[model samples]
Target: MNNVKGKLIIIGGAVDKGSFTEVSFDQNVANNLNFFETGIMKRIISESKHGEQSRLEIITTASVIPREVGPEYIKAFAYLNAHNVGVLYIEKREQAHDPEVLERLRNADVVMFTGGDQLRLTSILGGTEFHDILLDKFKNEDFIYAGTSAGAAAASNNMIYQGSSSEALLKGEVKITSGLGLIQDVIIDTHFVQRGRIGRLFQTVVGNPRTIGIGLGEDTGLLITGNGRMEAIGSGLVIIVDGRQIKDTNLTQVELGKPISINNLVVHVMSMYDTYDLHTHQMEIRNSQYSIPLMAEQDSDDADPKVSADDRE
Candidate 1:
């Protein structure tokens, strides 16, 4: 999807989906657990305490059904619950379309997509009634949605969700596919630096210089404003590749199965409070995110980190 006005919170992977919100519900499904708490967890935890409905929700179609991930996203819940927010899970979206899922998504203030596989996220939800609902929901300011790993990748115009996080952009390795239609100005990649995904993200932008590429590190996310400007949130960095300035050579001849050579590709790093203009391609240093101050105002209550919190290990 091109540009729709909504928020995108991209994570490294494995954000706790259930406990983050303050709402209560009977468990109807389950999924595996993995990944850690990027600093965003702390923010959500503090917010849920006031019992004021915060804007955010999570969708884990990427890890849906037997691979359910609701139980796995506790840190995310701890953060959301701290704010008295609500979190919901949706499984069985693989071959089924449930309208209630969309209803819940529309009702929630923030919508989150958990990590797993970008293909799964898109293949299951794209074009479905629920997917349309998400698209439609973006038109409303009350909604702010986030995703991680595959989820983060799926929020872009194009997604590279499959494959191990190997840095080398080998031929036939950078598999690209359609995403949730949230942010279409760029192609999104996750587990960025750790996974060595820059080469692939760079390659995509080179092919289509008109398109920008964003590589978000594990536990790292980009806080994009409604105006299309952005800030880096979390402990890690979000990489932005700008191919617009490049006067490139020879990539059309690059064939599959054989590694391709890439020339100079402009890359930028976005860390906490960094501002990036999606349209003007301008990068700035901001005092804080216009809305939420990342890590700066963390009231930081003493709480044990999740059991698998160090997923990067």
Candidate 2:
């Protein structure tokens, strides 16, 4: 099995969705669209180059409705290759589950789940022999992981999603189901604003008043280190609802059919280049990349292509 310790990135939605339509499969051009301009994501790719992390073993668990993952998904590898990082993808048999898929997942260096239907995702992959092997892979080093949209939701111990229905978020309308629990204890909702999932996310936080709810909008993502530090990266913001310190919630006051009005809940909309300290549950503006010294940047990226691993500083 591939070592698993390293940085993790979880995107909200819009992962490699539009690139396949392009006639030319330019790795650079296609790659640029999938990743953000923020230095945090760059750092994830950069660290992998120097062995501070390992290869990205991407897993697309969602959109199993015969969704195709072609050359476009490998674009991240191209970005890594430019920086001299290796990459690989686990091939799945079309139209059904492949038994060996679990073994491949166990040995991945960096596992990533793709976007699609949340229910379809869990229905197929959850509680299966495949999901268990993937979980076993969670305990090694030189490996990282990531996910997007429905993929992001699956990272949490409990996931928020609309399975077969297109229901807007109301008081009790939000549905919660078991996730793979890699991230553990948080519930995730993707395509937040565009899908109007705020009310549903609120319903989730207010109802429990103990779990953290992370709602990621499209084209946005959270870049996190294993030490409980995370930076918000992308063009938009990540909405965080912390109910751990809540005093009261009227969720149970309303019946199952009614939409409940929530009050006094603390919410924050974090911007890009900002860091969230998960341990302290605080948010602060991260130092700009331009502020770091040239030597610091190079030392962080000092993986010489011509030298052997023994020669690395």
Candidate 3:
């Protein structure tokens, strides 16, 4: 774990995805801006350290429609009073290596990634000078890295590329690839509960017992300070899959395309305001008013859908 002082705001997607103002008929068009506001985005702005003076660089490199996605974030952040925001609309690998783009990234107070394809993000920015600087600033400065959906998914070393919830539990069904290497030894999945991704997350930890699996619900965010401690933020849940203490498993014996069986895979379902100690693998209730619920245990035949194989190599 790096002893860096920077912070990360990994947010789920579709967070406060509001429709056009003229289409929304609830209130005055001007007053309807709240619909576009999201708890996670607001939290990111607050964590920017420089407040109004913050220069945020929106990287839309992951989005297939980088032009469209870039403007959306610029507009959204503008509503939050972030007047100095700029977009890094890099579509190809060569653009990611641009000197001007790298300089902008270095001078920016915060660099945010927009939702799209996580694989595209790593492929384009992987070994470039831009990526090196991003990693350096994240470790040495008080910088904050924020992303939504695919953006959030690309923050870790192990990234879930493509796999549906229905086919998740089966061995090899969940496809994972190398990410941006921002956060190490952890797999992050977005649109968690809303998309029924628990099974996929469970399988990820089972395959790599030492790595942690974080499922960030829509409108939810996990604030990681230092290295292994994370505090839940926003309105949704954060599911933590800890596979370090497995006692038995049929995953190895099962043939390809067969359902996987595991005896004791530890799972923790946490909500907003909950704090988890990644190093200790324990959930710490920051607020004493709430009771600590028993940790969940999963087996092969848990009544949920079983498992499959990943077609994408």
Candidate 3 C-alpha lDDT tens digits along 181-241: 8789889999888789988888888888999999998767798877778989877788888
Instruction: Judge candidate 1 against the unseen true structure and give its global Cα lDDT, from 0 to 1.
Output: 0.62
lDDT by residue for model 2 over 239-310, one digit each (tens)?
Answer: 988877676656677676665666677888877878877678887766654577778889768766689888
> What's the alpha carbon RMSD for model 3?
13.8
Provide the lDDT at 13 for model 3. 62
Model 1 stretches astray by more than 4 angstroms: 1-5, 14-38, 42-52, 64-68, 72-89, 93-96, 163-167, 286-313
TM-score, prediction 1: 0.74
Each prediction's whole-model lDDT (CA): 0.62, 0.62, 0.78
Clash counts per candidate, in order, are 31, 8, 3
Predict model 3's lDDT versus the native. Answer: 0.78
User: Over the stretch 1-313, how does candidate 1's per-residue lDDT look in tens digits?
Assistant: 2355555666654223322211222253232212223456544333231333454455656664422345435333553443333445545463335665556666766666765667867777788777777777775544566776677778876777555446346566666778877776688877677657688776677778888888877556777656788778776778889988887556677766556666677888878778888878899866534655646446343334663448635
**What CA root-mean-square deviation does each model show from the true structure?**
11.8, 10.5, 13.8
The order of the candidates by TM-score, greatest first, is 3, 1, 2
Question: Least accurate stretch of 10 residues (summed lDDT) in model 1?
Answer: 17-26
Q: Candidate 3: which stretches are off by over 4 Å?
A: 15-38, 288-313
Please, what is the TM-score per model? Answer: 0.74, 0.73, 0.85
